[model samples]
Target: MLRALCALLGLTSAAIAAKFELSPKKFLTLPLGDIKPAGWLHDQLQVQTDGLAGHMHEFYDLVSKSDWIGGDSYYSYLEEAGSYWFNAMVPNGVLMNNSIINEKTQEFLEYVLENQDATGWLGPEVDTEKPRCLWGRYPFFFGAIQMVEYKPELTARVVDALHKFVKLANRMLRNGEGVDKWAATRWEDFVLTLQWLHDFHPRGEEELLVDTMVRLKWSGVPWEEVFSEEYFPTGPVENLTNPFGLELSWHGVNMAEGFKALPATYRFTHNQSDIDAANLSWDLMFKYHGRPSGAYAADEMLAGLEAVRGTELCLVVEAMFSGSYLYQVIGDLKYADRVERMTYNALPATLTANMWGRQYLQQQNQVAAQNMSPNPFPEDGPYSNVFGLEPNYPCCTVNFPQGWPKFITNAFLVTSDKKGLVQLYLGPFEVQTTLNEDNLVKVSVETFYPFGDNLNITITATKSYMHYIRVPSWIVGGSMTVNDGEKTGLVPDEVTGLLSVTIGKGLTKIALHYPAKIVIEERPHGSIAVHRGPLNYAFDIPRSEKIIAQDPREPHAVDLQMGPIGAWEYALDADPATMSFHNEAENDDHYKLPSPIFDSGKPSVSIAVSACSIEWPLAGDMFVTSPPENPECLGDVKTIQLVPFGATKLRISEFPVFAHSEPSLRVGNSYQIGDDSEPVQKPFNPTKPN
Candidate 1:
């Protein structure tokens, strides 16, 4: 009977015999807690745990007194805010192994599971006339799915409850019950959860799961049509209400989540157009709205590449999630590159070093983080860019916690065939998983990547296996040595760009050396952004932070108004040959990363460049306008220090080019310190597909 049904659906006989049937993913994601952050990455997670992410439940009304947890204070009728917190906290708690957080997460999970409505609804909206929006369950079930993956004992109960909810959701979606404004446009999230069940725990209910996914896709916004040239916005969206009315395509958060909608749908359809549309969406998004921080400009709506324009923190984290998802499904190197870029640069730029406060919006040329009177954001409020708890909205407050935890989980992925272990993202992590169902592989990565140019990888495997590592596009020339023997130049596959190496039985050590060089990228208005590896370099402006408001229950959780105290109008010299790189961690074995590594002045790497103050003006006395084209140098040239973009709260990232000399240098060529030879200039052809 299953084979007949599979034949009817155009599925293979092998798929019919399998647990569930869906188009195979290019790579398999490890279970939530299979990989753990280590070293500086570990410290990052610990800081997150000690900050707003860990303590939100104690004081925050939306989380502490949420409707889902049997409390009265509900953020919305959809009951999404608390579920956002749950989705983030579950993974963080499990990865950090924090007992307190774990207990809270488990309590919430148990409450929702035990309180399932008799009609099969999962949330608090039991009113049949006004059926609850299915959107909220997207995040809630995401967290529940993670919990089930980590704890097998609860899988049966959770799966049963989810199956019941799925039945109701199928009926509700078919009858046009819960799919509405936000829910209709963002239905891909629900499809993702349904696909998870179909892939992992569909106990003889594959047909129902597939049917639900299809219905949800039909009810959701047509992303392929939305991304087509005829309908997509070529520039910044002006009238947010007109062209894309009712679709909410201009909204920042929706765009971020919707970016992966077609990709998710492709899993069932297996259509090439779906993948092409997703890829096209990515190219167009970054082309028009891309920021130097590896995020797009969408303060509230889809803004342009103007320096003063801000990107929402929620958009930043959501884009990271979408990027990671795209990479897992399509095995695209560009997606992985984007995820790493955002993770290293943009994710930390919006938050306070302690992770207690975060900005709702972050701008590339931000010189101040105070409330703006005439800001550039089209739909956001004046307080959008200020760093605080729930600065502009509470959604970011609950949603931002998922960024680091999910990144850690996605750092290592098993190849589709399960015969190869792939290091998808560079970070300090330890992963223990079974490859090929029997070969147990435990790989430990230790290094300060993007901060330092060395990776110390140790693979302990029960049997010989093939290991693959992604060679970042920014690398000029990297080399690897096995067992500290003769070094070989790292060569990546021409098609996939992955550096493959064979691993033997038992334990083996490998050392990778990638020379870090300064890269100059030309931005709009002839401005330039500096890069070394995945880290974007910016002029870190010293700031004076004033406390404006505080949480009465927790005085430490305060809103801050910050402004630059130092000169931030500097423009870099056009010639890259004169730039210098400094590594303070070099030759200093006693050097230790500060408790909060993203804090200003804590980064061990700095770029010294010859620059001068340019005649730049402020936009509405709030933030700097676009970099002045060929502006006159206001002062004598001086050496200025550039730190990682994540290290600064107020920064000048996109700088004007100060043309003080002749045309002897090019923009794409990289500069390495201590090399006595003249630098070779090369045309900049970015690895991003057009």
Candidate 2:
């Protein structure tokens, strides 16, 4: 079955064999500036620029005067605050081409690179006897690599400095120097940098790079063993006292970063068990702790499936990055599906619509965004869910910027054979890259995806090539029409879920329609969640936000305490088959998606369903606890609209189902919702020879 799937994905025997011997990446990611955001996506980036992404450095002292840039004080013991800012802002600056941000990024990069110690070690750590934590360098190098990609002149300097660091890292790992703390548990970031250097700019240092990877793997946490069924935690962790011991494995951000370690190491080991364990890691995570918003419960530690449990913003972005990496390495459609799900739903749900202030943690069924006594999170503080600057910690403030920029750059990938282009995730973006070695191709995708069902793609190529469009597993009966000709049904490869189309040179226009339908997902405690396309839907509770605190340096950026101004205790009282979509876009031909599309009252699509007010009680006067197993309607059923999950600041995503009189509606040839179908966890066999 694995061999047959590989063959279906166009993997030749040679390519399959290469998997066991430092194989080529399944997809080659385009550089940072190659893919530019367009349409609403462009607006989204611009808003980020005008918000924290663009101004944080100017006002935030942790970033402006961090030790990495030679400041006297630092934000954390790991010295990663500045590096986190750099990792996020560099991509944002380069993608938006913002002069101010780009200039600032260069200034920071110059200081860090020029001040590298004679020992090849970066940062401000000088105590030689003490064990150095190499975790900070991982994010620092991630940003530095992008800078080199955008500016080729710095390639030599950056490459030389990285080589020196890797040599130092290799020696340190051999001894007992680094990897003593968080670095040991989350060493995938370090290995990822090594792999990048090996694949792109080995410069005769390939052996050293491989050795460094091996040493890192050996010294790092044995994630394969941890993710095994015998050891993997099947429920929320209760022990919070020993956070640095075994409990660190359950840390949300650590789990998000560590899950990808085995998959990444597989590129070198080519061990089939590593691949299986990697797939199982994902399956077990979602099964036990998954949230309806595509995030797993991890406030600071692994919280359970209770709706009130918080998922940190840092975890959300890290999971998206890991998911995208898994897709690129394993070439599985399921990983891509997850990436889309998080990008469309969870990423935006945690932030303020303007992107100025963000929550340290978000709840799946949050009724208010405020501080709580006896907080819901096992390890986070009371203010974790409030919208503020550095509410619980500053990590998210710097780390969240990488989410969208990386997503855009990874949206389109060149196939491993370099003969075709694969549209991995759908969005409004323009990509300019070479396929088949030097065949320059530029493709523009314009769509209100997750809102509108159609993608209008225009391709202009110097040479004809095969274009593989990923048909999202959520999409049913998708079809395509080329050059305004008759529409043809698209039959995607069963395993890969990709529809291949041949594209000729010059201008080619294509219209792909993925008819969106509602899906009812059953959740714990007799609750249910609604979905359409890649988006998760929620009851948008109207809220009144109060400015509780303001940053004097940037007064417009203020912390918010928001509570529901309207009714939020509601239960679904209608059949899924009878629900209808209320799309604002359909009513107007010239509908423009509102700027800051994630804001309330701006949703382009919504679902109107029969619901009744219920007497769901709060856990701690702030947290919306689990709904009643059989919620009784308080009064007559009324129609309420559910907007996209990302658009609501206060929402009920998982709702209790109120038994209705009508039977389940089944339309002709329509997909049914509320089915008991689990996601297929098919492990790819890396040892399979072509």
Candidate 3:
């Protein structure tokens, strides 16, 4: 069955592309508990489940009362705002409900029901009352997916409501004779809706699914109106239009790789044209320019290969959702792997480690995280968020929470029994399923991963059925072994880059191979980096040490080599290594910041850091953004040892890799940190002249 998943995807290289049956008692619903924020995900959604619920409610209630909803409403902003609330609140309310928060979510849901239109579309929010399909439709579709899980009967209504909304837009695009220019995008919300409807609808014909795909153009975003661009490139980057502005045309706009929709629509219907369209779209978006972050657009504009400038907060979340869905739609493990990798690194890296904060816009190569501006809104402290999230456009602020809550659902799902294909890793969640006609299986996971590196899955079965545990691509030592039978553990399948674990009935133990130490390596994109295993190791920076990250003062920058190997044995071979460090040099620039933000009047830069002595982990963004001093930086002779980026939140990430002018002559190790002596160098040469 796992092989079939990979082969099924091979049917249409172009088209990429879940849920539950309504029979037995605990069929489609997900399990819940004091779910630890495990995997690379948890940290983002924790705020919604814990602290941010109140503020979110206030924000939702505040928006619900505004002229935000109307027959001719400017819904892009409202939908974005509502989506921000629904994505976090809806799933959290259903899976990890708190009484106080539930009341707010119910109110939001009721408001939508009250405003339903006769056509079955609820989008009275557009100006001129013209119901466009894609943009505003997604947040509502996502909210409905959550609602259906909460209230089963609402499933039909949710489907009908979205069907009405999408059908209306489809009519304008395909059947409407004089509806001006219509919008039908593959990447838009409607495809997400269609994918949902196809997978879970109680009783729906395949024709509707076929119809959705039949009308789309394989061309790029249709650039007939609204979006002003000069070139219609493959990917959606800002200013990627032609000189005269007419080219690969997509859903009436440029950089709109609406191509992702066709194969997705065809996933259920198998329309080759639609599949062809989706593949073409995928080729275009990536061929032009894509980032390692899985986000290509620059500030909602499509700019290709502009390394220093790329990806928005909204794009990161949206792309993750799309990629995960595509993985499910195609039953391809690789797609799931892509989704997992991007979320683990790019998504979290986009926002602050804590969910409460985020950047309005992030530059891919803006290495220094320093803030030069004062707080725009008094209530929001300087370091609380990124630049300029004022009166509106708080997209990242509201939308960021959507990542993890939705991600938990994608973390694991049911696969076929015959094929040993556990397409995902980090599972062992409670999956209430029937093996024979009578027996049930409840799998519980217990392990402190990427940390402790051991797993114990206790599978309690009602009857007898086979379960496959996904084998990760990166196994440090050897493959996993299952107690079920001879070599029950999964071996790697070259066809589908995933390991499998197939076990039969009753309680079973599956041992997955994991390494104790994890080191992150660099990829070609030249943005932020990632580690193969769990530990996201950065250059160690000691908090108590006076060493700071960057020097914004003298245009100082740092760079490094990529794909450098040998981290595994690096620590083991350390010969009683003695290292030195210093106190984090406070930035005077930060002192110039407003109240509660200014520093303690310390210097803008520090000399060096102790490799492992990070005392103040709380001093996040503060230490790294502190600018260094001039070349006379330490006068005659000052030498300090530097640590890893992960070692200190206040330490630097973006550095001037290449030191120009031959280091301007060697400055001695006079500038000391901690209690260390002069530095020592152990050089290795393949052809050493001893």
Candidate 4:
């Protein structure tokens, strides 16, 4: 393959002399478009906006005007909710650009600017006037740094405030001041803020700020003391923890928050001290925090060392956003890899399938919640989990926006030589770097990712620049061709490889090979699971809604294939039609039955899918699943297609051992499942003792 200059998307060398400018933001022209994953974020934003419509303006007014203690708790709730929307939106959301929801952000900005003191502090209810003022600027900076299209002046204001706060805080700390005797821990926040100031200001006041932050020394707080782990983070929490005893002090995701801010410490000032401090903390965090979902743990109470506790909604959103930030600054595929896993498995697992809502917390085993709230809320908000506004806590209520759609920022970033680089592999369209240098390069990349084999990169070359594309570390025997002339084959490895293309000089035609791959990794103790791309599929289960009428034999175990995706094709083994449905009596412990207490201790088996929808008349449809035949003993059920654990609405991810190995039932080719030959059965009783 020789070097040849080809036309860039139909543009010739003569007209390709567009001036390229450097962007202070990650990718220069990111003003227009929505976030990534596209499944939940788009709908959630639209619905969340609608949900806030009735109280949106009022909510902003409440935050701006409410006095801390003189008013009712509603004001505090309003402040909390406003804080959530403010946090979730700016970095990424419907208001990142010129949208209706942006008005709320403007209102917040107005409030901040109007309330600034002569000393440059802007916070409410301050007793000692600590550096708490810095917390308010995150919203502004998050927006100004990302959206190059809107609010440039606002961005400058954000930068100005950042410097002001850092300088003021340095003086305060020097004079021995800043939030005396606080219940919650908020140490690295100062580290992060100083880092941000360092990064934002080109003139290099970051050194002094970083030094000041390092001296603050609030890093050693124990895990249990914090008032809210959701806001005032403490301790090391990870998914890879052993669930045995009263291990209250271990949490990986909680620790990962600190790790997340580590690299940011370095990127701000390019200094080794800040970087080293961050790395030492991050290295320890990753050791305890890494999880099976490709994320570090922190579901709820820190289940340390192994995934004792499950993941929480707040951790999921935060972990994903943190991973995205990690990807952008460090350029590590592993971070992006973790982000994709959390996005697909842990993330979707947190929310309901219809996008109406998500859970406050999620457990891997998720034993039947002796008393779970089915319709937790009155259905006021789209994903509103609480009775109306606030749920288990304000964490997920405000943090949900960061989970799905905000992934767009993590999709693409610029390389050292002014080229485009793809971070995570899950995708649909080809993403261009839009920047020739720092400014808009006026380019669009065209390709369908994650769906099929080929990916095309068509760049409208403004000038000859270096373009680097990530060849996914997961792709097996992947091959790529440039301009349909030169072709190169790639070897699969644990890490990604860069494929470089020079624009205008033979960058016209493009094709990249995505090998269909299956990943098999051994679990900690025993057993192995398989993954295809980002999806980890398990054995196909047969379902039936008819069984809801009958009783379930057992609840602890479930029937699934020996492996993740069934290796052999057996059609008749599982039937969705045999599932049943029944209303359990209030306080009725055992699987609710129409008749008297059963001799056997078991649950009535209804299709898991039906378990989610039957609770609501909102689901209007007749063909839920087909009915079972004489299923009194086997548990009567109506049948329908049952998605694997990963796909089901109310699913069990980690099932017990007995169900995995079905001695009587085995999959075979040409055998149709859900037919009369093979009966599909599962235990659903939530240990309701008669």
**Top model number, lDDT:** 1
The better candidate by TM-score, 3 or 4, is 3
Root mean square deviation (Cα) for candidate 3: 13.1
Better of 2 and 4 by lDDT: 2
Model 3 over residues 532-602: C-alpha lDDT tens digits? 33222233222231112322322111111111111100011011122222223222222321211111121
Better of 1 and 4 by lDDT: 1
Stretches of candidate 2 off by over 4 Å are 1-21, 66-78, 126-131, 240-245, 660-690
Residue ranges of candidate 1 with Cα displaced over 4 Å: 1-20, 65-78, 126-130, 240-244, 660-690
Candidate 3 has a TM-score of: 0.63
What is the lDDT for 444 in model 2? 94
- Give the Cα error of residue 460 in candidate 1, in Å: 0.9
Which lDDT tens digits does candidate 2 get at residues 41-95? 9998898889887898887877874444443334542367888888888989988
lDDT tens digits, residues 1-690, model 4?
A: 000111311223332122211112332223424223232233334444444221334443333334322123322422244544555555444433435456655665566555556676644444332334233344344544443334565666666765665667666665665533221133454555555455445355644654454444332233222222232323332333423232332333344444454454344334444434443443444444444445444545454323224456766776676666655655545556556666756665554333334455554423222123332122112222211123355445455665544565556556544455443445543343345454333334443233234566565555566565665544445677877576787533233344566657323656777653333332322222234444433323222211111113222111111111211111111222222222233233332222111111111221221111121111111111111212122222222322223343333332112112232322221111133352221111001100
Most accurate candidate by TM-score = 1
Better of 2 and 3 by lDDT: 2
State the lDDT at 527 in candidate 2: 80
2 or 4, which is superior by TM-score? 2
In order, what lDDT does every prediction score? 0.81, 0.80, 0.41, 0.40
TM-scores, all models, native as reference: 0.93, 0.92, 0.63, 0.62
Candidate 3 lDDT score relative to the true structure: 0.41
